[model samples]
Target chain A: MKSTWMMRAFALASLFMAGSAWAEVVVKIGFAGPLSGPIAHLGKDEEYGARLALEDANAAGLTLGGEKVRFELVAEDDQADPRTATTVAQRLVDLGVRGVVGHVTSGAAIPASRIYDQAGIPHVTPSATSPKLTQQGYRTSFRVIANDLQQGTAMARYAADTLKLRKVAIIDDRTAYGQGLADAFAEAGRKLGIEVVGREFTNDKATDFMAILTRVKARQPEALFYGGMDPQGGPLLRQMRQLGMNTQFLGGDGACTAEMLKLAGPALKEGAYCTQSGLPKTKMPGGEAFFARFKKRFNMDVQLYAPYSYDATNALIQAIKTAGSADPARYLPALQTIRFNGITGPIAFDERGDVREGGVTLFRFENGAWVAVP
Target chain B: MDILLQQIVNGLVVGSVYALIALGYTMVYGILGLINFAHGEVLMIGALTALQTLGVLERIAPDLGPLAQLAIALGVAVPVCMTLGFLMERLAYRRLRNAPRLAPLITAIGVSFLLQTVAMILWGRNYHTFPQLIPTTPLEPVSGVFITPVQITIVVVSALMMAGLLVLVNRTRLGRAMRATAENHRVASLMGVDVNAIIGATFVIGAGLAAVAGVMFASNYGIAHYAMGFLPGLKAFTAAVLGGIGNLGGAMLGGIVLGLVESLGAGYIEHLSFGFLNSSYQDIFAFIILGLVLIFRPTGLLGERVSDRA
Candidate 1:
């Protein structure tokens, strides 16, 4: 009788959990990113893109095995810290989410991915491009953005072919994301026959780079590439200008933001180069209406990563509709088959779950705006 | 040889800034016989004041020359910082003067938190680029060395400030009074030295110097934020202790020596052997130096007799 009671109690607890989770017909997807920091704009933009996809998918009436299903979105702020990412991931798991769409920046995503992997949940990153994130070969992890290899190569090519840089200086914030991008760029620059002159490292919270700048000015590299976000990048730009380092800077999408321009001061933005994924404002895919609605809803400017996030969430929703089940293991193959066209260009995934037909645009800070490379 | 020379130049520029900030911490300690743990926060406030002034000036006249902008910053940061320094002493430190030493230490910590929270609430949790005052171009003609005008300015200005301080402490009446108060406050009070007035003046002067250092640091770095003072504060304290806590000269020497050791340890010495040390561990080196100094000579390089004894 005691054994029977224990079994029954365990069964009841699971049933309660399942019952509560399945109580809602909506398919819930979890999103995570640093929503409040130096690089928060990227996370904010990603949230935007995900929100649009959700609205459109819900309007289209999601289906699973020809049955109607609803979709819901849940977002958490990781604040760009690794430990916080783990905590947020656990919260989503405890909430019984079917799938997740973030853990932006490899620093946060690397630690958080472990929780989802153990729980057998599918997580797709739209913006995190760190090579190590995928090098571990986790089945649960996916990224829609091109990795450091792609962006780094593009950065090198731009410097050598277009910018005509013969030598360049490199600085990294020593984060997995920053270091990864910088290493890739340095390797690519070397292969392109561009001289890699000076290399420097800084901490995440460091604001002063004068000593480093003074050193860089001495080297007189034709260009500088800083692999960090707006907080560090903006100040570096301003200091470079103040220090009279006339060389242009080429950085990843991490430095591409209104916040960066504002932080660097308007004058310093001139002659800087940045590479970001997807379409520019004029060339957005089904983005004309999205931009208008985003501005109206958020009452602020739209950011770069929001489009990718929208696609990631919408793609997950579409997959759940086709699979007709919340079990990601059984349902994720349908997601792997995600070929639907959505915001930030058409959304699709390869064997590694990276975006198939994606490339980064090399943009320059001209006047006060980021202009696509001519 | 060239790399080593370059690194030395780097250390000197950085060391001078460290010296200026360290003096502020030491002076406050010398006067009150208590560690003003909020000294770092005082530096943060100075940066914010300069930032606000720059913003207002830039908006009012975008074409204003850099010199004009700097003038505006001086006007804004000076009055604001002096008032802040005076008010903080009166409101926070004054009441706890007669309390146990630990109480004032605790109050200083609370004041640090209060200042940090106020900064966060007002500035929003984001990175704002602080205006740059110094030109960052590298200076040449040293043949084997690469240095910048800004670095030279740092060394020169810091040395000059330290010199001025020495004269102020040794050659002036207020200095005499301050030294007497620090030596024995009750006795000094009996002697009509106006103990309260001296303490208040000490805070104001220390804050003014910190403001100048804050501006220099921000201008060099190109940005400032709410949490800027945390690490630097800890480093300045270590400098004070390493130099022999109660001595002004010791603090300046300690700061420069610490900077030189770290830069050389990382740049030249790190690669010499099995590759244990590097620039990344430069911060760690400072603490190690401090620990060694404490273990060997806790009173610091100089005697801890109050400034009056010197």
Candidate 2:
């Protein structure tokens, strides 16, 4: 009698589980970035941000088309390589991910954007800032951050108007993002009457910059602008100091990271400046609460792009809710015209799928941290 | 003129580390006729081990002097790398001694990849800032030219080590046994030279040099990562081949010459290419020289012993 009673309880539990599973619809969102490399910390930050957003969405217990919905995140490592990005994108598509929030570096995102477009899956990039990504006119490609043009213009304006710098040199790591930002900065600097004394290029994997710095030093520019991430930027600044250049240093969002302060160490001084693609975190709409919650969840401080990533993931989910379907075909239009207030700010995409009202902020290294220049 | 001097100084510092690593490749090739492709990974292991030691030293003895801490780290790294080298020879190369040449070469590559993967798991993918035990403050040895104390240390230390190695090989009784083993293992064994011991000693000595080179490389650049050894390792291999794979003096000379060529190439590539290219083409100079050397002087500079042995 006891055995029969236990068997009946097991049968009832299994039936309940089956019924619930049938009633709930599982939706997968893909996230791809460099998860194992020098810049992996930044990639992981973005992934965790997306994860938190999904967790929050799941907890809200929303119903889509009268069925309870569940959200799942599928992550892939692209290693920040363009070739690997395409393969990861195809893999995500094959895995039936309804949408993607990924390909952090512009080099990876631009190439992977073609894959998502071909597969008819929409992808929103949280950190990639190269203008060409959206210029390609792919309906599936959307960006939630300010492009390189805005960042470069803001930096050049600050350099000319505020710092009153007359001449500067430029260096790039030769990735799509680096080169694009460097070119945009050069163009804007010319318009602002700031002479670009020199331009040099290096690869993303390089650690040594003595040779190039020596060449740039000969030009004797008052300031130097480097368009690359912190990995290269840190060493470059150190080498520049070693060469005794003592010139002011400027960089874009790629180098405007908390990691830069640690990597550059003592070389990052008062003269070092960078431009981030959005307002400072303290100025964001829900910045304080987000920071406390993020720290509680991950036991780490937010890196550069986490807030934007969180907003992008939420934007996708919001679109799915408005469309009342998880199908990419059903939600693509909704995503294109979606409007919502995000942790970063108000979010709405324009005709080219670039985020509207995107703002840029300038920061300077002060007291060993990036301080907003106001 | 000042720019030229700075580039040359930079080249010499980088070349010294390459020469040190190349010695390991050359010595192993001389004795066992093996390229020891994983030799670079040994250098990487040495650097990371030193970095790990430094971390522990910081926690346990935070008040230690920088130089003393560095010495302790090197002391630990050298022995660890030596044991690793001996184990690699005993377990991997000894069994493949009679296999086809391609087999050992492939095995060396596999071992290299394995070491990198293992390092990745242990250290994770973040680039650790190698503590600058030696101060990086620049000193102007000449007007308009900057040289850091770390650079001077690298050059001076590499020269001392290379000179010591030369004396050991040329003057010691054990060196005589090593030379005998390299000439003919079967004949050396018949003559009671203890061929196995000499080969093992060769790997140990090479690994010791690699450890020093690895530490110096990280110190000069101020960063350490798992994949840091690949490029330097390949370049050092090119140096060994360029200097004549079996020759010690040739390895040193090839490394310095290659470094100079790369630095000068990067410094002037813009003017040479009429602005069509930049210093990003710096890596091309090494391969170009390697190609030219292989085509014209297959025996390499100072390479009289390679053809006679094999």
In order, candidate lDDTs are 0.78, 0.91
TM-score of model 2 vs. true structure: 0.95
On the 0 to 100 scale, the lDDT of residue B56 in model 1 is: 82
Report the Cα lDDT for residue A266, model 2: 86
Task: Give lDDT: candidate 1, residue A195.
Answer: 94
Correct interface contacts retained, every candidate: 0.31, 0.70
Say which docking band candidate 1 falls in: acceptable
The DockQ-derived docking category for candidate 2 is medium
DockQ score for model 2, please? 0.69
> Residue-wise lDDT of candidate 1 within A12-64, one digit each (tens)?
99999888766446677888998766566677777766776777777887556
CA deviation > 4 Å runs, candidate 2: A1-21, B305-310
